[model samples]
Target: MVPDPDLQLQMVIKALSETVSTAVDPGNKVAQEQLHLSIATLGMMRSRLPMTRRFYRALAQDALTLAKDLEEKTGQSGALTQAMNDVGQALTDPGIENEAIEQSRARLHEAITDHLAQIDKSLGTVARDIVMQGSLGSIERQRAWFVESGFEPNADRIPAISELIQTPDHP
Candidate 1:
Protein backbone atom coordinates (compact mmCIF):
# COMPACT_ATOMS: atom_id res chain seq x y z
CA MET A 1 0.00 0.00 0.00
CA VAL A 2 2.78 2.37 -0.84
CA PRO A 3 1.52 5.84 -1.61
CA ASP A 4 2.91 7.65 -4.63
CA PRO A 5 5.77 9.84 -3.54
CA ASP A 6 4.67 12.63 -5.80
CA LEU A 7 1.14 12.57 -4.42
CA GLN A 8 2.40 12.54 -0.87
CA LEU A 9 4.64 15.47 -1.67
CA GLN A 10 1.73 17.35 -3.14
CA MET A 11 -0.38 16.64 -0.07
CA VAL A 12 2.33 18.02 2.17
CA ILE A 13 2.65 21.11 0.04
CA LYS A 14 -1.06 21.68 0.23
CA ALA A 15 -0.97 21.27 3.97
CA LEU A 16 1.82 23.80 4.29
CA SER A 17 0.03 26.29 2.07
CA GLU A 18 -3.11 25.90 4.10
CA THR A 19 -1.17 26.41 7.28
CA VAL A 20 0.20 29.69 5.99
CA SER A 21 -3.20 30.86 4.84
CA THR A 22 -4.79 29.98 8.13
CA ALA A 23 -2.16 31.97 9.96
CA VAL A 24 -2.57 35.08 7.88
CA ASP A 25 -4.96 36.72 10.32
CA PRO A 26 -2.90 37.42 13.40
CA GLY A 27 -5.94 38.00 15.55
CA ASN A 28 -7.52 34.64 14.89
CA LYS A 29 -6.80 32.46 17.89
CA VAL A 30 -7.97 29.19 16.34
CA ALA A 31 -6.03 29.80 13.16
CA GLN A 32 -2.94 30.65 15.17
CA GLU A 33 -3.26 27.41 17.08
CA GLN A 34 -3.74 25.48 13.86
CA LEU A 35 -0.69 27.13 12.37
CA HIS A 36 1.39 26.19 15.40
CA LEU A 37 0.33 22.55 15.32
CA SER A 38 0.59 22.30 11.54
CA ILE A 39 4.10 23.69 11.42
CA ALA A 40 5.25 21.26 14.08
CA THR A 41 3.72 18.38 12.14
CA LEU A 42 5.39 19.62 8.97
CA GLY A 43 8.71 19.72 10.76
CA MET A 44 8.25 16.16 11.92
CA MET A 45 7.41 15.02 8.41
CA ARG A 46 10.41 16.88 7.04
CA SER A 47 12.71 15.00 9.39
CA ARG A 48 11.18 11.58 8.86
CA LEU A 49 10.51 11.63 5.12
CA PRO A 50 13.66 12.05 3.07
CA MET A 51 11.96 12.14 -0.31
CA THR A 52 9.72 15.00 0.82
CA ARG A 53 12.43 17.07 2.46
CA ARG A 54 12.86 19.47 -0.42
CA PHE A 55 9.15 20.20 -0.59
CA TYR A 56 9.01 20.66 3.14
CA ARG A 57 12.02 22.95 3.03
CA ALA A 58 10.43 24.95 0.30
CA LEU A 59 7.30 25.30 2.39
CA ALA A 60 9.32 26.44 5.37
CA GLN A 61 11.13 28.96 3.23
CA ASP A 62 7.86 30.21 1.85
CA ALA A 63 6.51 30.68 5.35
CA LEU A 64 9.63 32.58 6.31
CA THR A 65 9.30 34.79 3.30
CA LEU A 66 5.69 35.46 4.12
CA ALA A 67 6.60 36.31 7.66
CA LYS A 68 9.17 38.80 6.48
CA ASP A 69 6.66 40.42 4.18
CA LEU A 70 4.07 40.68 6.92
CA GLU A 71 6.55 42.14 9.36
CA GLU A 72 7.69 44.77 6.88
CA LYS A 73 4.11 45.70 6.08
CA THR A 74 3.03 45.88 9.70
CA GLY A 75 6.25 47.18 11.26
CA GLN A 76 6.16 44.52 13.94
CA SER A 77 6.95 40.83 14.31
CA GLY A 78 3.83 38.73 14.70
CA ALA A 79 2.80 35.18 15.36
CA LEU A 80 3.55 34.20 11.77
CA THR A 81 7.12 35.34 12.16
CA GLN A 82 7.62 33.31 15.30
CA ALA A 83 5.93 30.25 13.79
CA MET A 84 8.05 30.45 10.63
CA ASN A 85 11.20 30.82 12.68
CA ASP A 86 10.31 27.77 14.72
CA VAL A 87 9.64 25.71 11.62
CA GLY A 88 12.74 26.96 9.80
CA GLN A 89 14.93 26.18 12.76
CA ALA A 90 13.49 22.69 12.90
CA LEU A 91 14.28 22.00 9.26
CA THR A 92 17.61 23.79 9.08
CA ASP A 93 19.76 21.14 10.74
CA PRO A 94 18.23 17.74 11.22
CA GLY A 95 21.41 15.96 12.17
CA ILE A 96 21.46 12.18 12.75
CA GLU A 97 22.63 12.32 16.35
CA ASN A 98 22.84 15.19 18.79
CA GLU A 99 20.94 16.65 21.71
CA ALA A 100 19.18 19.00 19.32
CA ILE A 101 18.29 16.15 17.00
CA GLU A 102 16.90 14.10 19.87
CA GLN A 103 14.82 17.04 21.03
CA SER A 104 13.57 17.60 17.52
CA ARG A 105 12.57 13.95 17.20
CA ALA A 106 10.70 14.08 20.46
CA ARG A 107 8.83 17.20 19.36
CA LEU A 108 8.05 15.54 16.05
CA HIS A 109 6.63 12.46 17.71
CA GLU A 110 4.47 14.56 19.96
CA ALA A 111 3.24 16.61 17.04
CA ILE A 112 2.42 13.49 15.03
CA THR A 113 0.44 12.02 17.89
CA ASP A 114 -1.48 15.25 18.35
CA HIS A 115 -2.21 15.47 14.63
CA LEU A 116 -3.49 11.90 14.55
CA ALA A 117 -5.74 12.63 17.48
CA GLN A 118 -7.16 15.68 15.74
CA ILE A 119 -7.70 13.75 12.52
CA ASP A 120 -9.50 10.99 14.37
CA LYS A 121 -11.63 13.51 16.20
CA SER A 122 -12.58 15.66 13.23
CA LEU A 123 -12.57 13.28 10.27
CA GLY A 124 -14.03 10.10 11.68
CA THR A 125 -12.48 6.67 11.93
CA VAL A 126 -12.42 5.96 8.19
CA ALA A 127 -10.49 9.09 7.36
CA ARG A 128 -8.13 8.46 10.22
CA ASP A 129 -7.45 4.97 8.88
CA ILE A 130 -6.75 6.31 5.41
CA VAL A 131 -4.34 8.93 6.75
CA MET A 132 -2.56 6.40 8.94
CA GLN A 133 -2.18 4.01 6.00
CA GLY A 134 -0.85 6.78 3.78
CA SER A 135 1.58 7.91 6.45
CA LEU A 136 2.92 4.39 6.95
CA GLY A 137 3.34 3.95 3.22
CA SER A 138 5.15 7.26 2.99
CA ILE A 139 7.48 6.32 5.84
CA GLU A 140 8.31 2.99 4.24
CA ARG A 141 9.16 4.76 1.01
CA GLN A 142 11.38 7.18 2.93
CA ARG A 143 13.25 4.31 4.54
CA ALA A 144 13.70 2.65 1.17
CA TRP A 145 15.02 5.86 -0.34
CA PHE A 146 17.59 6.24 2.42
CA VAL A 147 18.80 2.68 1.87
CA GLU A 148 18.97 3.09 -1.89
CA SER A 149 20.91 6.32 -1.53
CA GLY A 150 23.54 4.63 0.68
CA PHE A 151 22.63 6.58 3.79
CA GLU A 152 21.94 4.67 6.97
CA PRO A 153 18.55 5.42 8.47
CA ASN A 154 18.76 7.43 11.68
CA ALA A 155 18.79 4.64 14.20
CA ASP A 156 17.38 6.71 17.05
CA ARG A 157 14.39 7.99 15.08
CA ILE A 158 13.51 4.80 13.22
CA PRO A 159 11.92 3.06 16.17
CA ALA A 160 9.85 6.13 17.02
CA ILE A 161 8.73 6.43 13.43
CA SER A 162 7.88 2.73 13.44
CA GLU A 163 5.89 3.16 16.61
CA LEU A 164 3.74 5.73 14.85
CA ILE A 165 3.03 3.19 12.13
CA GLN A 166 1.88 0.43 14.43
CA THR A 167 -1.81 0.10 15.08
CA PRO A 168 -2.93 0.04 18.68
CA ASP A 169 -4.81 -3.23 18.17
CA HIS A 170 -1.86 -4.94 16.55
CA PRO A 171 0.93 -4.47 19.07
Candidate 2:
Protein backbone atom coordinates (compact mmCIF):
# COMPACT_ATOMS: atom_id res chain seq x y z
CA MET A 1 0.00 0.00 0.00
CA VAL A 2 1.08 3.56 -0.58
CA PRO A 3 2.36 5.38 2.48
CA ASP A 4 0.18 8.12 3.92
CA PRO A 5 1.19 11.68 3.14
CA ASP A 6 0.42 12.87 6.66
CA LEU A 7 2.78 10.25 8.06
CA GLN A 8 5.34 11.38 5.52
CA LEU A 9 4.87 14.94 6.74
CA GLN A 10 5.28 13.80 10.31
CA MET A 11 8.51 12.08 9.36
CA VAL A 12 9.64 15.26 7.65
CA ILE A 13 8.93 17.38 10.69
CA LYS A 14 10.73 14.84 12.85
CA ALA A 15 13.70 14.86 10.50
CA LEU A 16 13.79 18.64 10.50
CA SER A 17 13.61 18.75 14.25
CA GLU A 18 16.39 16.19 14.66
CA THR A 19 18.60 17.93 12.14
CA VAL A 20 18.08 21.27 13.78
CA SER A 21 18.59 19.83 17.21
CA THR A 22 21.85 18.08 16.33
CA ALA A 23 23.29 20.94 14.31
CA VAL A 24 26.90 21.83 15.17
CA ASP A 25 25.79 25.40 15.67
CA PRO A 26 22.11 25.52 16.57
CA GLY A 27 22.15 29.31 16.50
CA ASN A 28 22.91 29.62 12.79
CA LYS A 29 20.49 32.09 11.22
CA VAL A 30 20.49 30.48 7.76
CA ALA A 31 19.57 27.08 9.15
CA GLN A 32 16.87 28.69 11.19
CA GLU A 33 15.49 30.48 8.12
CA GLN A 34 15.36 27.26 6.08
CA LEU A 35 13.51 25.60 8.91
CA HIS A 36 11.16 28.54 9.10
CA LEU A 37 10.42 28.49 5.36
CA SER A 38 9.73 24.78 5.37
CA ILE A 39 7.35 25.06 8.27
CA ALA A 40 5.66 28.12 6.76
CA THR A 41 4.95 26.40 3.43
CA LEU A 42 3.69 23.36 5.29
CA GLY A 43 1.29 25.44 7.32
CA MET A 44 -1.56 25.37 4.78
CA MET A 45 -1.58 21.60 4.45
CA ARG A 46 -4.23 19.87 6.57
CA SER A 47 -3.67 16.48 8.09
CA ARG A 48 -5.40 13.42 6.70
CA LEU A 49 -5.19 12.00 10.20
CA PRO A 50 -7.66 13.31 12.74
CA MET A 51 -5.22 13.24 15.66
CA THR A 52 -2.76 15.86 14.55
CA ARG A 53 -2.58 19.36 15.91
CA ARG A 54 -2.23 22.29 13.55
CA PHE A 55 1.48 22.58 12.64
CA TYR A 56 2.32 25.98 14.03
CA ARG A 57 0.63 25.28 17.32
CA ALA A 58 2.48 22.01 17.64
CA LEU A 59 5.73 23.73 16.86
CA ALA A 60 5.04 26.43 19.38
CA GLN A 61 3.84 24.01 22.03
CA ASP A 62 6.78 21.71 21.52
CA ALA A 63 9.25 24.60 21.39
CA LEU A 64 10.23 23.62 17.86
CA THR A 65 11.56 26.03 15.26
CA LEU A 66 8.98 28.70 14.59
CA ALA A 67 8.22 29.70 11.00
CA LYS A 68 8.56 33.42 10.43
CA ASP A 69 6.68 33.56 7.12
CA LEU A 70 3.94 31.39 8.56
CA GLU A 71 3.81 33.65 11.58
CA GLU A 72 3.51 36.71 9.34
CA LYS A 73 0.76 35.08 7.32
CA THR A 74 -1.21 34.11 10.41
CA GLY A 75 -1.44 37.52 12.02
CA GLN A 76 -4.90 36.66 13.25
CA SER A 77 -4.32 33.00 12.30
CA GLY A 78 -7.73 32.55 10.67
CA ALA A 79 -6.58 29.60 8.58
CA LEU A 80 -5.22 27.96 11.66
CA THR A 81 -8.26 29.14 13.53
CA GLN A 82 -10.62 27.60 10.99
CA ALA A 83 -8.52 24.45 11.02
CA MET A 84 -8.73 24.16 14.77
CA ASN A 85 -12.45 24.67 14.65
CA ASP A 86 -12.97 22.13 11.89
CA VAL A 87 -10.81 19.40 13.36
CA GLY A 88 -11.86 20.07 16.92
CA GLN A 89 -15.49 19.79 16.01
CA ALA A 90 -14.87 16.65 14.01
CA LEU A 91 -12.86 14.84 16.64
CA THR A 92 -15.16 15.77 19.45
CA ASP A 93 -18.16 14.25 17.76
CA PRO A 94 -18.20 10.78 19.32
CA GLY A 95 -20.38 9.32 16.59
CA ILE A 96 -18.30 10.57 13.66
CA GLU A 97 -17.46 7.96 11.05
CA ASN A 98 -15.43 8.14 7.86
CA GLU A 99 -18.69 8.56 5.97
CA ALA A 100 -19.67 11.52 8.08
CA ILE A 101 -16.23 12.99 7.60
CA GLU A 102 -16.62 12.53 3.85
CA GLN A 103 -19.88 14.45 3.98
CA SER A 104 -18.16 17.22 5.91
CA ARG A 105 -15.44 17.27 3.28
CA ALA A 106 -18.08 17.65 0.60
CA ARG A 107 -19.66 20.57 2.40
CA LEU A 108 -16.27 22.18 2.92
CA HIS A 109 -15.58 21.75 -0.77
CA GLU A 110 -18.81 23.54 -1.65
CA ALA A 111 -17.99 26.25 0.85
CA ILE A 112 -14.62 26.76 -0.76
CA THR A 113 -16.22 26.95 -4.18
CA ASP A 114 -18.71 29.53 -3.01
CA HIS A 115 -15.98 31.53 -1.31
CA LEU A 116 -13.85 31.57 -4.46
CA ALA A 117 -16.81 32.62 -6.57
CA GLN A 118 -17.49 35.49 -4.21
CA ILE A 119 -13.87 36.58 -4.40
CA ASP A 120 -13.92 36.44 -8.20
CA LYS A 121 -17.12 38.49 -8.27
CA SER A 122 -15.68 41.02 -5.89
CA LEU A 123 -12.62 41.25 -8.04
CA GLY A 124 -14.83 41.82 -11.09
CA THR A 125 -16.53 44.67 -9.34
CA VAL A 126 -13.16 46.04 -8.34
CA ALA A 127 -11.92 45.77 -11.91
CA ARG A 128 -14.95 47.66 -13.19
CA ASP A 129 -14.43 50.35 -10.59
CA ILE A 130 -10.78 50.60 -11.52
CA VAL A 131 -11.63 51.08 -15.20
CA MET A 132 -14.38 53.60 -14.44
CA GLN A 133 -11.99 55.39 -12.14
CA GLY A 134 -9.36 55.28 -15.03
CA SER A 135 -6.59 52.66 -15.25
CA LEU A 136 -5.17 50.37 -17.95
CA GLY A 137 -3.12 48.17 -15.64
CA SER A 138 -5.62 47.15 -12.95
CA ILE A 139 -5.97 43.43 -13.60
CA GLU A 140 -2.39 42.69 -14.58
CA ARG A 141 -1.15 44.45 -11.52
CA GLN A 142 -3.69 42.72 -9.32
CA ARG A 143 -2.38 39.34 -10.46
CA ALA A 144 1.15 40.46 -9.73
CA TRP A 145 0.03 41.70 -6.37
CA PHE A 146 -1.51 38.32 -5.59
CA VAL A 147 1.83 36.65 -6.22
CA GLU A 148 3.57 39.27 -4.15
CA SER A 149 1.11 38.88 -1.35
CA GLY A 150 2.28 35.39 -0.23
CA PHE A 151 -0.02 33.45 -2.57
CA GLU A 152 1.44 30.51 -4.47
CA PRO A 153 0.21 31.91 -7.79
CA ASN A 154 1.76 29.07 -9.78
CA ALA A 155 0.99 26.15 -7.49
CA ASP A 156 -2.60 25.04 -6.90
CA ARG A 157 -3.95 28.53 -7.41
CA ILE A 158 -6.48 27.76 -10.12
CA PRO A 159 -7.33 30.01 -13.04
CA ALA A 160 -4.06 31.69 -12.29
CA ILE A 161 -4.21 35.43 -12.32
CA SER A 162 -1.51 35.22 -14.97
CA GLU A 163 -3.94 33.25 -17.12
CA LEU A 164 -6.73 35.65 -16.21
CA ILE A 165 -4.71 38.53 -17.63
CA GLN A 166 -5.44 37.44 -21.21
CA THR A 167 -9.19 37.39 -20.59
CA PRO A 168 -11.11 40.50 -21.66
CA ASP A 169 -12.78 41.15 -18.34
CA HIS A 170 -9.45 41.68 -16.59
CA PRO A 171 -8.29 44.34 -19.05
List candidate 1 stretches off by more than 4 Å: 1-50, 96-171
Each model's C-alpha lDDT?
0.47, 0.41
What is the alpha-carbon lDDT for the whole of candidate 2? Answer: 0.41
**Per-residue lDDT of model 1, residues 24-136, tens digit only:** 78788888778666655655555556434443343334334433443343334343444545655765665533444335434443443444444324445544454454355
lDDT of residue 46 for candidate 2: 23
Q: Which ten residues in a row have the lowest lDDT in candidate 2?
A: 59-68
**Candidate 2 residue runs with Cα over 4 Å from true position:** 46-127, 130-171
Q: How far in Å is the alpha carbon of 145 misplaced in model 2?
A: 16
Residue-level lDDT of model 2, residues 1-171, one tens digit each, is 355776677777777666754663657878777776775455424231332222112212211111122223223243433533453355446566655544443443344334334444535554344324332233333444344336654635533443433433312
The superposed Cα distance between candidate 2 and the true structure at residue 137, in angstroms, equals 21
TM-scores of the candidates are 0.27, 0.27
Cα misplacement distance, residue 136 of candidate 2 (Å) = 20
